[model samples]
Target: MTYFFPKVRQAQQHGWKGQGNKAGGWQEMSRVGAGARLFEATAVGIALLCLGARLEASELRKSPVVRAVERASPAVVNVSTEQEMQRRPGMFPGFRGDSLFEEFFRDFLSPFPRGQARTSLGSGVIVDPKGMVLTNEHVVQGASSIKVTLSDQREYQARLVGADPPSDLAVLLIETKEKLPVIPMGRSNDLMIGETVIAIGNPFGLSHTVTTGVISALNRSIRTESRVYKDFIQTDAAINPGNSGGPLLNIDGELIGINTAIYQKAQGVGFAIPIDRAKRIMRELIEHGEVHPAWIGVEVQSMDEALARSFGLQGRKGVLVTQVAQGGPAQRAGLRKGDLILSVGSSKITSRQEFLEALSAYTGGSQISLGVVRDGREMEVKLKAESLSTQEAVRMAERQLGFTVDAVNQASKKERRAYSMSGVVVRSVEPQSLSYRVGIREGDLIRQINDKEIRSLEDYQTAMARALRRESVTLLVQRGSYGYYLTLELGGGG
Candidate 1:
């Protein structure tokens, strides 16, 4: 306590100097008594602090939380992104549909105006000494240019490695050539509730702002428009809009999570991606440019105690298989309707989220053992999960067709769109291409081609190959769940 109150003690000693030289001996002694009383009060306060009441000022400055910020600040960065969005043709000065309109407005509808330049700010963490940085996908999505400013004020132009919108994570690379400071990574799996945590980010353009709180919850579920990743670390770390993708550190100054989202309506409620999950994603993005999702082709329902009884089961111990995809890994491995999946590998399945999580651990071509219950019997089955990279499906659509397409199960570049069935989505149609003229515009799903219903990537490709053989083809398309017919006639060599 005296260490924290040295200035007060020094002032008291100085204040009594002149009074002692004067005739006011009694006044000087009274001042000494006052100083002694103050010292006693300070001692009591320090005693209370030691008893876990509060922290002394000097001790607070040297706390673990402050030390964590000092250790991690060098790895934090401020991200600024500038994107040039293409401007479309706006309405002309004159109106009409024919000769007069075209004649009067010859200079109108000329070349589109220059693309609008938009700038945004966010936070990022330097994860590697090789100049690899991690941030939120939304922070740099569609950015024509990105600039990263380090804690030391060194700036560099960043290149996008890859971005996954579903995960809301993006990686950027800068050619710094020299070694960069990095934060020590910590394990979120070992994190306990109410453990001390620190968040450092650029909130509202405020760079390297530090906030501290306790881990409020773990494995929190976040629901967006189209997807949900059930593992998040909830903290009250004052994460703001621009704080997205910053580091969430443990008391040891090691990163345990990434600040991602905050509820607008609720105060002190913020969410972060656990560092354990992010490590895998970062490795995948660096190696493959994207994280591939592992999927088992089946429709599953969570079994409740009542539902288990109705299906003649004992307790709520497994997920029920309502339907299995034909020619899929589940069906090929003898999985059938009405079979109950009791466990995957060594982990028991109790919810849809848990089952999906277990299945996600295995990649394509990997063999997995499933413990299933058939009619009046329990059984073990082994199968190979059979999805090539879902990104490959998207790349196929873009390469073979005159447009980019999206699938229901794909991790989009910028969003998680709602797609109920397995059909290829027309994301962007090439200008003046047959797809554009045929009313096959963006947002249309090629549901069927000449009665060959498109249900998968294989079906879409086969139908497209058949359509290429004809000069014209009729396609049944679904636009926003509304079905319609479109006839596309191609010119020779188109």
Candidate 2:
């Protein structure tokens, strides 16, 4: 090609002649000049043909999926955590890894502890330029140290901002002098059923792995042995153990959900916490360090076939309101006892669990609309949810457990001197109350409620507010020298 360029130029300059033929007619110029012009035209055409082919190949390689990954991959991060665990020996010394035997005898194991350090790997996404990272709570739960690696291989030590175990969402903060890249958030409420979605995560210790799939389903519920997770966005993407906190993006490279691989038994099914729901919890976690249970002051029971028939609602789905707290949100909104709640906002309520899950989306002071059926007529009621007050919490404890508790500081000197720890002390217990039946005495100190440590009145109020929605509440009651875990059945007393 280089040799041809010089020859072509030489031919154009020297291959022309103006001469007369022997017949005295005008003579033709040199054919080399014409050939040179033809060659130049062919070469230009071939050059353009090659250029067009290269441009087409480039366009083909950059599809929407590729572009999305390119735009969002920088914000994806690898999360590694180290945790200290206490390993106890099994009853059968030789059956260490036997699944059947371990499952059968797990509860009978003794508390003989051995110290062990465990390391886990997961993925996260940077949501804020100030180094706010969002990941699953289980990723950093009980971790002694956390390390976050960005897409650029820059590693930083991370501190836990807050975690909500019930929601299974957590926030982490990393310190850096410069701003970090963040993924743009997208809404999940308007997501189509089969739209294209991409998941970016570290799967099996593989960093920044990309997988593409469609939204398989929405508002899906997953039930485990311990509890049920509701309102999950289901996708067929290949989410594995290490993909727990990664981003699920739409075609536009906007984050629509956080990928979670909770259902390990499925072949291709994976679930994600919807971005809309995650946003609500994220705000609470960042602002308050924890998510407070939103209370609407209504007690509901699942509507069965018999109950539906009794209420003249044969085929409609809803829950029956058994009680509405006086001066609470429901009562103030004109909701009464025996009202059939058909929906909470846009979410249809078919059972008590569904109602609770739907209500959990809102926070305190949020004005929500409830669809109700009163006297066989459908109506909507708007109410503002409020946090349960300390006084109201005490009354609720008495009503539910048949016991009343006061802050530790309010206890008598003898009662206060009896324990060196800080907690609430029982002021009184009704004889036939669930607490009394469980051998809880007046002098016993309540050290904990469920998993929450009750150190003050505010802690007890918050714990009781969250626990009252469950069927049973566990109390760690400390008598003179011994601590007892007592599970009290709620809604037993007037």
Name the candidate that leads on TM-score. 2
Q: After superposition, how far is residue 262 of candidate 1 from its true place, in Å?
A: 5.8
On residues 311-369, what C-alpha lDDT tens digit does candidate 1 reach at each position? 99876488888767666778888999888898886557786556765565444455689
Task: Residues 1-494, candidate 2: write the lDDT tens digits.
Answer: 53244544553476433332423222222354566678888999999999999999999999999999999999999999998777665768798889878766654553322454788999999999999999999899999999999999999999999998777899999878688999988998899999999999999999999999999999888887555677889999889999999999999999999998777786899899999889888988999898766678877788899988888888878988887888888888898888889998778888777787788776676778999998889999999887555566567777767888777763463754547347888888899877787798887888999999988878888888777655578999898788989888665111
TM-score of each: 0.60, 0.83
**How far off is residue 158 in model 2, in Å?**
1.8
lDDT of 1: 0.74
lDDT of 1 at 339: 87
